[model samples]
Target: MFKRIFNNQQPISLKWKWGILLFVTLTLFGFFSSLIYQQNALNIQLNQIQANHQYFFEAAINYLESMDEPIQRTHFQSVLDEANNNDLNNTHDSTLEFLTYFESNDIVYRFFNEKQQLVYETQHINLNPVEYSDSLKRMDVNNQMALVGSTKIISENTGESVGSFQYIVMPQLFDDIKSQMQNNLYVILIGIILFALAISFLLIRLFLRPLTYLVNSLDLVEAESLSQLRVRKPRSTDEWSDLSDHINRLLDKIDNYVKHQKQFVEDVSHELRTPVAIVEGHLTMLNRWGKEDPEILEESISASLQEITRMKGLVQEMLDLMRADHVDIDYKDEITEVYSTIRQVFNNFVMLYPEFQFYLDIESDPDELYVKVFRNHFEQIFIILLDNAVKYSTDRKEIHVALSTSVTAIRVAVQDFGEGMSVEDKDRVFGRFYRVDKARSRDKGGNGLGLSIAQQLVKSYRGEIWADSVLHHGSIFYVEFPILSDTRQIYKSKQIAKHKSL
Candidate 1:
């Protein structure tokens, strides 16, 4: 499970982001280290000098004391050489070595005693300085000058003067000093680079995370629907939030456009075909008989007239349907006389197809049985359903239409014992231009817009239409509309025009 969760499809950006982070970290560390190295080097040199001052002072004093004691020249020279070299041969160095170690960077040596001056002064001269002045200055209480009294010439072993001994010290730059500093700075720089890279990688990951989420989310999605492509968003006040909003808006526009395109096609087909059929139908009828045959001409003319009628109905229904879609109807709604409307529509349907059996069950009086509806809308609804029943009935079969009241609304059910529709056909029956028996509908001369227009008109008055059917069994269409009271004033308004006509 963990392996699957961390799949091997890491984004290219993640690697590059982390790489840049490392580079910046290393650069920063290097910069700081270089800064400290120069300072630390100066401090180290200062420490060395302070330490040398103490050691060198002791070494100078010891050389002065040795010269003060008279000693044999050769024997004294050997002891002075040991002190100057700072290399005592015992397990530990002697006190002389510790004293002379201060002058290790320069030269330190002890000469033969001053009493042996006869030969030594002629043979040896110490390095550095114009001279180790025989009268070097010292301070008195009144700042008066005096000779450095301890450095005076002395005897050898017999306490006779040989010569004066001197100790010299100088400063030298250590050969590896710069190299050590450079090495320290180099390690610091590397460490800085690594640290910077880590931080930079993290920042890049954070900045691009929303975009990456959108991309990875798309990868995981396995769908073509608009809803499926929606990505979860980050909760940050940043540019990423703006981008997410834009993406969602784009998807919404795409979905709306697709829906409109489908509707446009359906509307165009429903609107255009009826007129085209009328024209072609008339032309075909004339071509078949050429106006010479009277009977054929009558039949052709009648057929053309029927087509024209159907086309006119299609145009009117189109206008009504569009209005219903785009505008709210403001006409009055009330507990209309649903039974009377059914009786009237059923009579018209049977008059048009008298061979068919039609019956109604209006179980309530007009006052008690009202469906809140616009009269024109109910009329159209009644016509469309009855027309469909008559058209689809194969054996001129019976139609069962019943009107009843529910607690909140009225239901007017019309059942046709005809060549019934399939479950699929019933589902989309109200969609524009959808026809189950296309051949029959076309021959009967309909543009396939009646049921859709009826549905739209019904909904304009806040009603519902649905159908139930099996393949072989007959179909039943149920239309439910609102019920309303306060009919006394409405009855007076309805009777005014009728009374005037009478």
Candidate 2:
């Protein structure tokens, strides 16, 4: 039954739910409060009635006790009858006057003889006398409830017991007061429920306004319109505002990623088109005349092979660039000595370019200069820099490799007296497929992907790499990496030595 009333298919709104909860709570509180008030008020009135009964009983007993002789039951009966008749005659009223007097006074007197036989009771049309009991009790009189208090009448002169007297009170006045209080409480409960419902609705709307705006803004975002989409700032500087700011930042990152991806596709297609076209031309020549002519066949096959090799190198470098983004994840535990890696690359370059002079300088201990990086990648980055230095140098015919240490990082620099780049070229030298001198780069088999890959790898290791160059004098490429702590280096060396022994 409860589920049917509060069905999930048509769930109650937050505003209505809160309002109903508060209303029910207040209703229960008001009901209990009213019940307590009624109980206390009735108790107070009952206490006052009891006190009045005690006073009247004492007054009647005192009047009888002051008699000169022992009072008989007949004398008490005559006293009560005479008092009722005199009061009625003085008011110039009938039996109705006597009834009204007893009702207003809220008490009725009754007297019994010593033998407990016949007694005197206030005259009333619906009066019903009951057999006396020891304790105070309620009795039914004319279909109405009455509280009865009784006491024995004693003669002080004879020290003997006389008849008993009782006072009966109706509690109709207290009942009326309780009924009025219940009615007032009902009216107050209804008013509070209506007010709570209205306020709850208004508060819910106010609190949810920002959320509604966020939903609407999200709906406006589509693939085609992502770059143009923006979320509006809320007026309040609260958690809602902070949420909107974070969402906007996420949107900006996604927009940049999408743009870069599209550009990457276009650049790849352009770069491959020339090599593919050259290969096609060679195949066509071979198919037409090179098959019959030995010289033509030889030249065509050589040209095709060169273009295929260039395309293969280009694709490999592109893969390297893509992989650089996640290099840290792949080689997080790999550590290498910076001086050793640079020394290895320098030695290989010297062997390959025997005519050029290679100089090296190491100012830090090799073991203490350890960095978090893959060994092969560390060698590759320096090799790319040295290769570029060799290709671009015009006058000096000499290369300088330097490794130094700071408090926090290891710095490696490769300086060459090369044909240095202009300010504009320096800014874009790290872009994929960008070259300062296209003819020279092509002749040296440069695909312009080396420096870009080096930069990305350096970034993955939380390092920085940049070039300092002038237009004609020289260029120096510097890379800095945060050095591993001495404790870590020593621990890693011990672990490596342990594994080798095993």
Candidate 3:
């Protein structure tokens, strides 16, 4: 995600963010739907189990109704006695026997005849599977609790047809009720999931609306033609609107700045040239026609010479800076042995600034080494800094030159033990036409563009230059460029060391 943010060029749009939101919301919806669906299936199974239990309950009631009911108190007393006496047996056998009583109408009567010479049985019910159970029997619905029902049947003891009755009872149905409850739970959860999806869709659209408008406005813009751009007023004051307004203001400032720069260049040049031309014109006339008049000739010639020379020096410095500014430079990078380049620059400086004592420090590399850059540009950069050191040193007496190359880059530093500049002045030293001590600059003819031009030239070859100095101690100018690969760090440092030593 951080890489995505770092590398993306286009500004984010509302539509794209909206689409991501939609996709994530739908994914959550689908995830929850599957969860709900699984729960639903479980609920259905639960309901089926409850339904099976309800059928078993109804069957139990049907079997009970096949028994005879006790009516008279004496007869009821017999049943009470039987229930009391057989309570232990009833605990185990009655529930199972009750199901079998459904098969024969005479079974209960036969039991009574064999035991006590008593009453009748009403009817038989087959314990077959019914609608809710795995059986085919019809369930008795109207008299579910009616433990006995009348039936036409013959009692063999009476030898006549008669109305008879029977009953057996039990009352609970848990399984099917539990299943219905589970189905209800499933229905509720599905509703909640659908509701969440609806809310999510609304949230996504609300979050993305403003960004969409901003994108639509941006898409309508054309490059190289900001005149056609119309920054539509945003409905809300947000960061996006602030960004747009800021950009428009910046564009306006840039437009005006470029116009002013061109005008300043032309106006300053033409204005300075006019006075120079007028002074030279009068000097030429005096020298040509009044040569016999020695005083006029000498005075005219000297004044003319000074102005022309001043103009010439000023124009030359300006040209050098301009050339530095607009160069189409390519560093013809090769294995440039730094020891050789540094020695070459150092020798040239020592010869030119003869009065200054330059202390050389070129650390030896056991293997031959070179930096990957144009040697000429590197040498020129060093020469400019060395010249500055010589020019500003206290009466041109003390200077230091140091050179070293590492695995990654090469550094050349020239230090001057001179009256150093103040902190405020050091910051502006590399700016064109900036001077630290103007009085000293005039005496030395120090063109203020030298360091600026040198910096520009160094930067063209992918190198850097900077000055480090204090108010009293000294100033050190350092320049560095990348090192060459496959060049051994162990030098033939002495091979070139001997040349510079001489």
Candidate 4:
């Protein structure tokens, strides 16, 4: 039974668990508290019995010493009657409690001469002989717990022992008080445990209500409803509300990723279909009749090989796109100086297109501008823009490259006097497999993924990329990255280590 209740896999409700814990804790506390209270109460009663017994012993001894006759039982009775009447008539409330043992036979005493002959005693109880002590001792007498004390009676005149006095106080009032307290303690503990359990259950449920709602909301979410479903946030600004917000944000990302995956598959399939069909047509022609004629066979084989090359290039670019999506993870803690990389790529481009006019502009402090990007990937961003500029240039054949900086960012611009784009094309130029002029783009050997790859790479580095163009006039593509500062010198150190490893 204990194993089942505590099993981790088959967990119980938090409210009941807390309730049980509180119940046990409070029960133990109440039990110990009752024990302490009962002990104190019994001690107080015992002390009072001892004090009254001492008073009687002294009074009886004084009465015997005052007499000119020998001590007798009658003299002790007179002392007891006088003590009772005196306590009854006392106006002070303090002395009134002395009447319980004084007025009744509940307190019995025995007096013996120094030779051990009994001189006086009450007949109700026969207490066994006990050694004399300063404090009263509790012991069983006649099957009842009693306060017992023995003391020597001394003569005031000579300071000599005349007799010995012993007392056995049943203290029925003390016994009755103990019994009542025991019963009351049991009732109080049971009531306290029950009340504590109830309160704990209520409090636990109240505190966990938000979590319960969150769990229920999560249960309702299905893959199909991800885009439309949202967890309801609590009104209070607490950890539970923060949790709801995080879950909602996570769902949004999942929905977007699913949509992007679907679009990526569709775009790849559509792009592949045309080339696949071209290859298929050529193969079918060669098998049917083109194989018989050398010219036709050569033409079919050339077209098929060209299409196959294009397909291979498409596959390679798709792989690059995939890598661009994970650039942050693949190239973590990478940093580069802006000027050196730009100069190198520009010089290469100038050498490749020596006939075309090229211009370089540097508006920022090139030595000071640094950004967080792998040197190779950083160079790739500019290469794509420059190559696009070269591919789409008009008769002017002039390209411009500029490096500048803002307070927070390093900016690079690549401008070309090319066959520019319409507004619709400009808006969608960074979309996967998009092109303004499809036939012209294919004729120029453009797969339309260059700008998309650049965009993804820039976004992965927490940067931005965009283009502005006028139809038939020209286009300017811009890239921006946040510059690293003194506080982030750690990245530079990391870059040094990375280069050493390489």
Candidate 5:
């Protein structure tokens, strides 16, 4: 039954959790405070009672010592009566002064002879004999708690033993005060606790208002409204305000992502439609009448094959683009030697295009430059740049490759004497499926994804890649990667240790 009431599936709210926490804290504080207050008040009352008992016991002793030998009950009774009648006279008589205390207070005074026989007692309450002590001893008198004090008196002149002096104080007044204090304390504490709980809840709601507003705004956000959706910023300079700023930035990214996704879909469809239409047209013409004529049939088959091959290349490039975006995840720990990879790719390009003038300049050592990049990805970046350089060359079929090293980075620049682009084209050259001259790009079999893939790979390795081009002049592509020292030995040792552990 308890489990059903507090079901885990329907968990508690944050506000209630805060309230419960505050309640427990306040309750514990009040409990400890009450205990401390009660103890302190009791100690104070006990001390006051002991001081009064001592004062009265001493006074009674002094009065009894002034009397002659063989004291009688009449002595105490007569002296007490006189002390009561002259209590307001301000007389200095010891008997009167000592006995005057019995007027307004309830105290049992008893005097015993040297033989331990009781001589005089003010109250008839039965209190047991207490041992001589400066502090009061506790005992029961007439079904009520009382403090008892006793002492054997001695003569100051002859040093002879006098009768024993004893006093029993009920302390019912202290008990009454304590009971009243306890009741009052309980009432005040309960009232304060209730008022504190109310204030705590109000403060909790005030502090959490921003969170509630954010949640409400988020609840209204859907896919269709993402482009226009933005969470309002909080006014306070606290974590809530920072959270609001972060959430707003996230929404902005989501909006851009959605827009980019829509654009990419449209671009892919437009690129695929042309080749599909060409192939479909060729097949349709062949099916209708071109099948009977070998010339028409061969022409249609050739055109169809070309369009299919182009479509296949387009599909492969699209796959490569997708893979490039996630290279960091698949090859996070890869390390590649920069000098070797660049030289290898540059040599391969040099051989592939013998007609073009390819110059390779190495300003760094043969194998000193290393960077945090997969060898394959490092090679691909240069391949794209070199290929573009060769394909776009106009009057001057020359390409210069330079490798340089700095204290922090390894830099590679590929310069092509090609018919370059305008300022606008250079700025957007790395965008997916973006071409400055679409007709020329298609003729060169460029799907416009090569530079985009290069950029993605470079960014994945925390490197930078960019191009500088002048209209009708030439273009230079630069790639820079942070330098790594002694990475080869470290990587080798990690591999050895990993295999041993396995």
Candidate 6:
């Protein structure tokens, strides 16, 4: 119920809330502590006054005892009556004279008899009779705070209580000290509250300044102004710096993706335009003269058919590229034997290009070597690589397919002794619709999406693919897949053996 009330309260900024919470907590703690200290100090002062009053009272009583005169009730009463009536003319009593000396020093003495009746009091002060208790008491006398000390007076010879003596004195100096302390406490409290607020504001601003800058920078970013979105680097290597670094990295990825998307659209349009224009031109020629001329008709029909086939292949490759983006979700848990898949692709390619010399190398056991990839997708990857190798092989007409295993992964390399590629071509060979030899690629019915599709598929399977090429010494495309555990290899071998036996 309390939590609901708190949640429904008016919203506050985090900075102000935290600052105010800290200030309030400290202020409360300090206020209570100051109150306790002040109370303790006052108590100590009161105790000191009590102790001093008791000592002085004891000294006066001892002086009276040393006078060697017996204290008579009747005579003491007569002296009190004389003092109360302001008649000091005939007073020759030694105890009364001694008691009067204290009156001169600001101490008021009140005497009570065994019957609890006040017998005598100082003539200078008029004090009301108070209840006699075992302990000393504080009283308001003559409009001043005073401490009253009481003690029973007994005869030394008989050890019998006769009367009681009371002494009262106002603690003016201690009162002044307490008043000053209270004023100081109020001043300190006000200073502390003001300090807390100022420091909190400064600290919040100092800490949140970087965040404000970062937000402002983000606000400045737009579709056409992504390059302007640059957050200022923080001065320290703290969480703010880490946040800035992460944001910069995210921006970099977004920028690259946007640029790649734009380039992809442009490349696709450029690639399809040639084939489309060729087909349109051929159709126009056939409609004009090729209907009557059989040679022209045959030529135009063949040209149109070739362009159509190229367009169909380009469309299919584009679809494959799109599918590769989401292939991981489609085949997340699929697994395949790396050796068998490579062997199947190798055999097919060799038969498909009988004139080309194909060399195959397997450095791991074919039955034990496995990777995390769908079987068909795995075969498709190698087919693309092998196809490229065969198509690029020049007069040497030689290609090599090597499969090797490491402690962590399975490595496959497809090498072709072809016209090869320059460093620039090798770098961009896997880019969408990018061809090293554009005219040659067009003549050979290649739309240049093969390697790009292969790379994306390899990425989906958590694999790496890159090419190493020499200008005249051909190129080798390397693909690496993380190897499945030994347990998977054993299980697959058992399953394969069982299937074969059946």
Indicate which candidate wins on lDDT.
5
Q: Judged by lDDT against the true structure, how good is candidate 2?
A: 0.77
Misplaced by over 4 Å in model 3 are 1-336, 350-359, 370-376, 397-399, 404-411, 417-424, 437-446, 454-474, 480-502
Whole-model alpha-carbon lDDT for candidate 4: 0.79
Worst 10 residues of 6 by lDDT: 63-72
lDDT of 5 by residue, 1-502 (tens): 3474477766677877787787778777876787788779878877787788778777767766665554556666767666568654666655555655554456767788888889887666566667786556776766767778887777666677777778777667667877987897788688768866887788788978898998887887864488777777777788998999999999898887788778878988999999999999989998898899999999988988988888888888888877887888887767777777887998898789889888989875753556878788899999999998987899899999998888899889999988899999999999889987899889989888899889989988899999999988889999999887766655774585468569
User: If ranked by lDDT, best first, what sequence of candidates would result?
Assistant: 5, 4, 6, 2, 1, 3
How far residue 175's Cα lies from its native spot in candidate 1, in Å, is 73
Poorly placed runs, candidate 4 (over 4 Å): 1-71, 75-189, 192-196, 365-369, 406-408, 421-423, 486-502
140-221, model 4: which lDDT tens digit per residue? 8767777777767666677677777676677575677678878877887788778777776787787788878877777877
TM-score for all models, in order of appearance? 0.44, 0.69, 0.45, 0.75, 0.86, 0.73
Off by over 4 Å in 1: 1-261, 264-267, 270-307, 332-335, 486-502
Candidates 3 and 6: which is better by lDDT? 6
| Candidate 2 local lDDT, 412-447, one digit each (tens) | 999999889999999999988889999999889999
Higher-scoring candidate on lDDT, 2 or 5: 5
Estimate every model's Cα lDDT from 0 to 1.
Answer: 0.64, 0.77, 0.59, 0.79, 0.80, 0.79
lDDT of 5 at 242: 94
Q: Each model's RMSD to truth, in Å?
A: 16.3, 6.8, 14.2, 6.1, 4.0, 6.7
- By TM-score, rank the candidates, best first: 5, 4, 6, 2, 3, 1
Highest TM-score, which number? Answer: 5
TM-score of 6: 0.73
* Candidate 3 displacement at residue 140 in angstroms: 25
lDDT by residue (tens digit), candidate 6, 1-502 = 4565479775666666677777787778778887888788878977886787677777776664453323446757766777888866568776767766665445667667777777666644666666654455777776777777766676665567767777777556556777988898899788777877777778778887888788888877764478557677888999999999999988887887788789889988998898899999989987887789988888988988988998899999999988998888976656787776788889998899999989999875755566778787889888988888877778899999898888899899999989789978888899999888888877787789999999999988889999898987899999999988868554775576567569
Q: What is the C-alpha lDDT profile of model 1 across 1-502, one tens digit per residue?
A: 3454368465445546466665656676668666776668756874574455445544455444444344345554554577457555542423344343543433334444444242222123233222344322232312322112124344333454545554433223332454566677677767676667666677777777787888876675455666557766678867888888887788777777677558867777766776678668777878876578888778777877776787677778677777666324455423356777778888888788778888988767654465556556678888989888887777648898888887788888889878888878888888777788888777886667788878877776778888898776778888888766557746764675357559
